[model samples]
Target: MIKVGIVGGTGYTGVELLRLLALHPHAKVCAVTSRKEAGMRVDAMYPSLRGYTDVVFSTPEDAGLGECDVVFFATPNGIAMGEARALLDAGVRVIDLAADFRIGNVAEWEAWYGMRHASPELVAEAVYGLPEVNREAICGARLVANPGCYPTAVQLGFLPLIQSDAIALDSLIADCKSGVSGAGRKAEVSSLLAEAGDSFKAYGVAGHRHLPEIRQGLSRVAGEPVGLTFVPHLTPMIRGIHATLYARLVRDVDLQDVFESRYANERFVDVLPAGSHPETRSVRGGNLCRIAVHRPQGGDTVVVLSVIDNLVKGAAGQAVQNMNLMFGFAEDAGLGIVPLQP
Candidate 1:
């Protein structure tokens, strides 16, 4: 079995890692670290974990994380960079579910995240862990930087069009909305239920952190710098992200066929039928990204709609997908989670 350790197992993504790893046939949660919740039984803090596993949380200094085959950092953005190097030096592969080692340009990452990178030397070596685009690189990576949630939804929606050169690279727009849970398990005034409920408003219209990451990913696929306007909104729900992407059609091509063919063999990306709209709830609680392509009135504009659980395909689950690839397991191992519904 793949012995695994999770850093910061008290947040939404941390607990999520525990949830999925518990059901994995070839993996075991050897350790989970949380200074605040140290010594607490896993199932006790999150009753949902009841009847699943009985591992107890440990403080990072005492977790003996070097003994594990892999370590997942589900902590805040800066936390992973501080500890990833030590674990990697100990022969433990690291997967950071944060923005620590994602952007290749060190200065750019620091400017946006507002902190100096702890291990800039490893940034170039750290593979951006989007299995759909960096699968081969992840297979041999010592450290994998998991992509941000918004970037995941936006990039997947625009990949086919950009790769085919069917759309104007400079004229791309991604209007995305995510559930409140994407804010993490925090008690901020903005995230309070009474404050965020009954409200639907865009917060990052001027520019979002996900903008650079999305442009970086899409640019790689398009082989050129892409000009994109990415705006993110907070919805009243608890999970999922819905991205409505728009791009001008500069070339004539079958849009639906392009989307379908691009994701044909990709098990996690489901391209819905033509004219069908994908719902955020349809992908909730699962490691699936459902998409649909459209052309209204046969105009020069093409729209792609994509949806995925902000915490699943958007965060913890995708991290697991990368771990599977790095360890030679099926890409979907421990990630064939069915979406939760009413």
Candidate 2:
């Protein structure tokens, strides 16, 4: 079995990594690091992991993670850069679930995240870990930077159109909404039940961090610099992201052509029927991304709607899918998780 370790094991994404990896047929959870709850048993802290893992949380320095084949950093944006150099030097592959290495430009990274990148030199080497687009690069990569939840939904929704040169690069707009859990397990006053519940307000409209990351992904496909207005909102639910994308079609293309031409054989992504609307609850707790296409009445704009469980397709489960690709295991090894329906 491939031995694995997780740094920052108490957060939502960290525990989520534990949830998915525990059932992975080819992986063993060797270490999980947490400074606050260092001596506590992993399962004891999260009873959901009761029978699956009995390991204890320890500090990253004392976790003996170098012995493991893979390490996942589910910490804040800047935490991974500090530990990545040492872990990689010891032949341990790293997957960061933070925004540390997503943006290729260092200045842009600092400008959005508000902190100097701890290891800017390594930025060039860390591959963007969206398997659907960068699968080949991830095969032999030592470090993979998982895309953000909003970016993931937006990128996947618009990639095919951009790649086919069907849309103008400059006129892209992504209006996305994510559940409260996307904010992470932190105790911010803004994230409290009272503040978020019964509220459907958009934050980070003028300049959200996911804007650059989304542009980076689309630019790669467009073969030109792409600019977009990304507006993100918080929903009252616990999980999922539904991103509605609008881009002017460069040439006249019917909605059906866009659907059949792009996602015909995609397993996890389903292009919906002509008039169907994709919903978040339909894809909860699963690695599925449901998409739909529509042409605005008497307009040249082609509308695309995409939905995914933010914590699954957007975070931890996607991380496991990358691990399977890196280790030569089946792509859906532990992630054969179907959506949990009502």
Candidate 3:
């Protein structure tokens, strides 16, 4: 079995990781770290994991992560950077489900994240773990940086157009809305039911952190700088992200065909049939990114609608997917979760 250690097993993503790995045929959770909750049974805290995992929460110092075949950092940004180098040097592959090594430029990363990058050298070695764009790189990477939730949906929605030069790169808009769980397992008042429930408002119009991450990915595909206006909103729901992407058509091509062909071989990205509008509920609790492309009035504007469960495809499930690729297992191992419906 592929022994796995998870740092920070207290968040929504961390528990989701445990839930998915429980069904993995080739992997097992060896350690799950939480300094404050050390010695507490993981199942005691997250009752959903009652029978699958009997592993108790261990302090970070006692996790013995270096002995594991791979370690996943489900902690917040910056936590992975501090321990990744040591784990890698010890021959334990690392996958960070945080933004620590996602951005290539160290200065830009520090500026946006408001913290010093602990290991710039490791950042150079870490691959951006977007299987669609960097599958080859992820296979041999000692450290993999999982893409952010908003960035994942936005880039997937815009990729086909940018790669084919079918749309204008000068003006791209991603009007995305994410459920409150995307905010993470925090106790802040803003995340409370009274504040986030029955309420909807855009929070990061001024310039969200995921803006640069998405721009970098799309610009790389377009072979030039892209002018993108990304605005993210907080929806009342508890999961999923719905991104309505707009781009001006610079050339005429079949948008539906383009998307379908681009993701034909991708297991997680579901390019819906022509004239279909994908809904967030269609992808909730699943490791799928369901997208639909549209052109209004057969005009010059091309619109793409993309939906994904913020915690699954956008976080832990994607991390596990990376692990499978890194270890030469089936790409969809432990990630065949069907979307939960009403």
Model 3 compared with the native: what TM-score?
0.99
* Candidate 1 local distance difference test against the native: 0.92
Clashes of each: 0, 0, 0
In terms of TM-score, how similar is model 1 to the real structure? 0.99
Q: List the residue pairs that clash in candidate 1.
A: none
lDDT of each: 0.92, 0.90, 0.93
Error of 3 at 187 (Å): 0.8
All candidates: CA RMSD (Å): 0.7, 1.1, 0.7
Instruction: Tell how far residue 96 is off in model 1, in angstroms.
Output: 0.2
Q: Output the better candidate (1/3) by lDDT.
A: 3
- Ordered list by lDDT, greatest first: 3, 1, 2
lDDT of 1 by residue, 31-81 (tens): 999899899999999999999988999999899899999999998889988
lDDT per residue for candidate 3 within 1-342, as digits (tens), equals 989999999999999999999989999999999999999999999999888989999998898998999999999888999988888889999999999999998999999999998899988888999999999989998899999999999999999988888998999999999999999997889999999889999987888999889999998888899999999999999999999999999999988889988999999999988889999999988999999999999999999999999899899989999999999999999988788887
How do the residues 289-333 of candidate 2 rate in per-residue lDDT, one tens digit apiece?
899888878588988999999888899989998899999998899
Instruction: Point out where model 1 deviates above 4 Å.
Output: none
